[model samples]
Target: MRKKLPLGVSLFAMLLLLSSQAFAAPQSELWPTWDNSNESNSATFDHSQWQHLLDRYLTEEGQHTLFNYGAVSSQDKAVLEQYLTDLTSLDPRNYRQSEQFAYWVNLYNALTVKVILDEYPIKSITKLGGFLSFGPWDDKATTVAGQSLTLNDIEHRILRPIWNDSRIHYAVNCASLGCPNLAKTAFTAENTESLLDAAATQFTNSEKGASVDGNTLTLSSIYEWYGVDFGDNEQAILKQIDVYRDGKPLKGWSGKIQYDYDWSLNKP
Candidate 1:
């Protein structure tokens, strides 16, 4: 007799097919030419193995998951914190090109979650204070492979030019409901396409992001912070938003965006 199909066999089959086609070879396999010989990348991650690890840790529930950190459904965020600690202990030199890429992406995200958990009830991320104050984001003093790192360092130092992909903005969610929703999975060089697409879609859809009503154009403060990354000027960012509008009709759009960084630990 033939083996019976599972209850949701059809859906599972569809997903498996998609995953098979969608999943690309790990970064190490793809970019054998990359030469980061030293341990500039974190040791715990294997650029070759990190994609799956991130997706798992990101989706993992209970212990390292944030499903039950403050309560509702699970401890997914809690799980994330533990993983952050675990990642910090890993040897960066152990990972190659892609593994290091995935590790930094995961590190940035995990740190963001940690920030919100510490100040769960705050209205905005800015409340943590500024450069001198050690706001919630600043307080993120985790040891990655024995080195203390901050969110700023991760972005400004590691992830930025190393990958040299500005699209990274979408991947790193700020935890504001207005900001892109933290992806349910971690970002790896292999699955980067999916993550970047998700980030762009989320940023476009969020009200805090660029939206239009008739001839008026409204945009999120993100456009302001990394405007240079988007384009040479405001017009450059506006032009990008125009494409995402899906025929929303462009006109004399102009407005000032008030920045509201989300610090509410991306729970749930």
Candidate 2:
């Protein structure tokens, strides 16, 4: 009646399918509700709690910043939960654009950490998803201003679309080794610009972000996944990268361009 493929062939096919899904990025489409911001509003949002969590748990190991997911105590976890609750309770629409940017970035990162800690001792963040899901990104992580928002919603729908800044790719950390380093300090309206530039520079120079070999230019899957955010073509992408790259700039590369990402947990 039906024929089955060999075990080896089936395994290979499955791996290929998983790989394809892993690199798939969502498009940046605006959610009009989040587009409202008050330039005249001079209010400030507090993020010291998030910074405290980061200072205690996040550390630099080699070029990557690893979070101590396993070592976080129950008390600290409760504190984290409180911080997230306080963040989502407010309406960001009434805040200034600068403050709103910091709020979303901090919220996105905190929610990601909470997700991992809720189910620690895992090898990769990708494993948190369901049978057909690649990650917990699409799952409703938090409710902001009575609007249920997922990690994808905060990133793709809000931050990317509202700000329309390519540097945002460096701001939102995904709690993975391949993702950009989570900032050591919490972002504030005053520090967001500097933090964004610092992250871009650090990631562009690191091996996990971009590397060149003889004739080949290999990059993190982030560039390929969100290529449109980073200029949408090889030359344009390289140009944007060069702006942050420290050493000799990457010039013409007529050879193959490759992209790879590590889904492993960013933890010590």
Candidate 3:
């Protein structure tokens, strides 16, 4: 004979079941590694030229920053092209862990900017084509260490898998207003940790990041999509966001979660 549960107990059990399903483990496997352990120190990569260009083109506002994509001069563009060439020419596996981390991050951002420049006056990054007319993420954008790779490769295969840090999402911008604001300076090996923390903090605190109202919580689609990277469940995800939120209220944030994103070019 089966004993029927009480109504309140049944409702509580149902809620728990829904919660478990809602925050299921991420489908993708995350394997963290630092490719070059034999190297003691990171090689100094010259990003001053890139820094100079960013200073001239990146405009900062109260909460977010924008890039003056239309203002990049041909001479400046040449410098960027040369930078990418130099980066691609190097053997990434030869660099130290810190160096390689910064290298991949900078390479990804530089390439994103280049793609946007190549298709400037366009509405959004999705306009760029990938396999089957998707975004340019899967397009073979560059070669590194004698291997042809795409933006998706640099991010998902290399950075995300190697570092296993959810912060990588904030570091690599998609040249969209919905993405994290592009840092005004180049990410150097020395400054990489601090810069990453700053980026996460900034993004989590922004209106585009998340907001709590009454019993409802609204968050970026990023959290919804990459929720596993942040935490095992919504509670864990909210806790991670609070870490970078610097004393912001995430506790008692229950009920519903909403997501929003903007795909427009982040231009000034």
Candidate 4:
């Protein structure tokens, strides 16, 4: 004969098993580090030049309005290209973690702008890909550290995986209105921490970040797609959002969460 446990006992045992399983899971690695200074004694890599260009072109709104593509001058284009070349030449392994973070972010943003310039006059970035694809994020757009790399490589493989910070979602602009504002000032090693925190705060306060209406909570598809990057579950994501929620965060927000994304080019 067989004996059955009480329903309460079965539930308690199940929860205990689940709890142990969760505790056994390995934690993600902390940010990568290098045994070198945060400075470049070789060549001064100031992104202030890029900041100047961004200031000249970007208009402040919830979305940073980029000027008409055709209006971009040859001189500006040359400067951007030179910056990319200089950045690619540097060995990030020689820089401090903060410097490396800034370098990668700047490289990603600059490359994104270059992609838009190379294929200008498009309605959406998604249209600039193969007939069956939406965009060219996977294409090897440049070489770094003697290896060819793509936009996906910089974002997914390196930045997101290595750093494991969700604030990055607010730093890398995809040239779309749905993305976080393309910062007016360039990211510098000196200002990386403050800038990252500011970016997170700004995005969460914006409508594109999180919107609540009664019982429904709407979030950007960025949160949904990259949920793991944010945290373990919805509550974790909400906790991150609450940290930067503007005005008043919704109370007792045990509501359904939905996602939306706009792929339109963020042009003036």
Candidate 5:
């Protein structure tokens, strides 16, 4: 006959296990975790880990499987599966927004990349005959965090809602040639505020972005694309830039220039 365990002993063992897990802080410093340089809030990033993550998820041809719309090749899907496995262990609270934002943004973008990679060589994202055929991409299909998250969900639901700041437009790389370059490293929560500020300043400083050279200000099309993101009016938008920018006086000139969007999907 088998002996029954005492209730008290079983309870004690369970409590011990739970307590140890509670005490074990998640590993914050590990593969693919962002570490802030902590120098200037403006320049706080350590990309060594992020670069590795990018190499792992992004295909050798500089593409991804999931975010690929309908063109995900078998090779791409294999890599994406590996990435998802690694990501399952991630705990966002372990790092700062700068650190985690990159993770989330990249995750979103990578997933989209995988979608497109599945149907590699497609002329457009809409050829697959789903909500993608419609204008609003948010209707497209995806699942994250047990919720059906569309591309719009990542941008509108998770990213915009959490940050509540427009400057993110500059930092959250959309994997489009027109989108800002993906930061070489991930942004850390500790550095998020400063990083966002820097992104605004960097874009405004660029003559290509928004600047005046002898009364001729050649501005990037980003301003035109999401004008409402800045403010109701163009001048209002420029005023915000004025608050952050230095060097050549911006108070004097204001006018229109050509609008441009980089059409090439951001590839290696």
Candidate 6:
């Protein structure tokens, strides 16, 4: 004979399991269509409109880069819509790999901003979804080359699988306070490399990304959620972080590792 758990205890355990599963990191499955990029093409996509919007709304306060979402003028909103329209109008497969990378990153970021602006005054991006849903990540946000895409699809399926670069995590913003800062300038083929390095360096050095107190190390939930992307283990993850930390490599704070994140909207 086996002992059964009390009803209340069983229910609590079930809820805990469900919550953990809900927030688990998505796998990087390739969307094969996106893998088709021309290597020799020299064409460049113009991201000036997005750059203008970023320059106008993104402001840095201490360690955080917040967007002035409430300050966006109706005219500027129109400009944003036009920028997205222009981006989606073309086929990224026709461009070079560098151009495609920049295009996808810019589109992903602009769509996230538009989602927040569409539902302004919310406390967090997670509120955009139903009780069981995890934000609007799975909801169709836009279309490109006749294919519909969600934030999740763009990130996990397209960007992550295509590049297989952990730095991709630093480039995509989710409009949340705990996410990597949204760049003040738009991504372009010419500047994507430097931008990725800068973003990684800025975030890894910030307390929000990783901090040490006594013998404990506290890190952003990004590493917890997407551990496989970094290295799938504590030692490998620490090595990735050390590559970006400002000064000498992190040392001694190996006692306890904790991960946390804030879900508040990244807005001023």
How well does each candidate superpose onto the true structure, as a TM-score?
0.64, 0.93, 0.85, 0.81, 0.58, 0.93
Positional deviation of 242 in candidate 6, in angstroms? Answer: 0.4
> By TM-score, how accurate is candidate 2?
0.93
How well is each residue in 1-268 modelled by candidate 6, as lDDT tens digits?
8999999999899878877787888999999988998888888999999999998999998889999999999999999999999999999999998999999999999999999999898899988966667789989999999999999999999999999999999999999889999988889998999999999999999989998888778899999989999986788888899999977566434589999898899987
Total residue pair clashes for candidate 4: 0
Relative to the true structure, candidate 1 has a C-alpha RMSD (angstroms) of 19.4
- Residues 173-197, candidate 1: write the lDDT tens digits: 5555445555666666567777777
Per-prediction RMSD in angstroms? 19.4, 2.4, 9.2, 10.5, 18.3, 2.4
Question: Candidate 5 residues 62-97, lDDT tens each?
Answer: 322112233434664666666654553454445555
Model 4 lDDT, full chain set: 0.76
Per-candidate clash tally: 26, 0, 0, 0, 34, 0
State the TM-score for model 1: 0.64
In candidate 3, stretches whose alpha carbon ends up further than 4 angstroms from where it belongs are 1-34, 130-132
User: Residues 13-107, candidate 3, lDDT per residue (tens digit)?
Assistant: 98677645632323443323425543865467777777877889999876668889999999999999999998889877777778888888999
**How far is 173's C-alpha from truth in model 4 (Å)?**
0.8
Candidate 6 clash pair list? none
2 or 5, greater by lDDT: 2
> Cα deviation of 88 in candidate 1 (Å)?
1.0
Tens-digit lDDT track of model 4 for 1-268: 6889999999889867754452131233333332334454443456866786787777765435454556789999998898889888877767766777788898898898889999898888877755444577767778876878777777776777677788988998888888887777788878888888888888888778888888888898887777787777888888878887867664357888898778888888
Runs of candidate 4 with Cα error greater than 4 angstroms are: 1-44, 62-68
Candidate 3's displacement at residue 149, Å, is: 0.7
- Give the whole-model CA lDDT for all candidates, comma-separated: 0.56, 0.90, 0.82, 0.76, 0.53, 0.91
Model 3 pairs whose backbones collide: none
Q: Sort by lDDT, best first: what order?
A: 6, 2, 3, 4, 1, 5
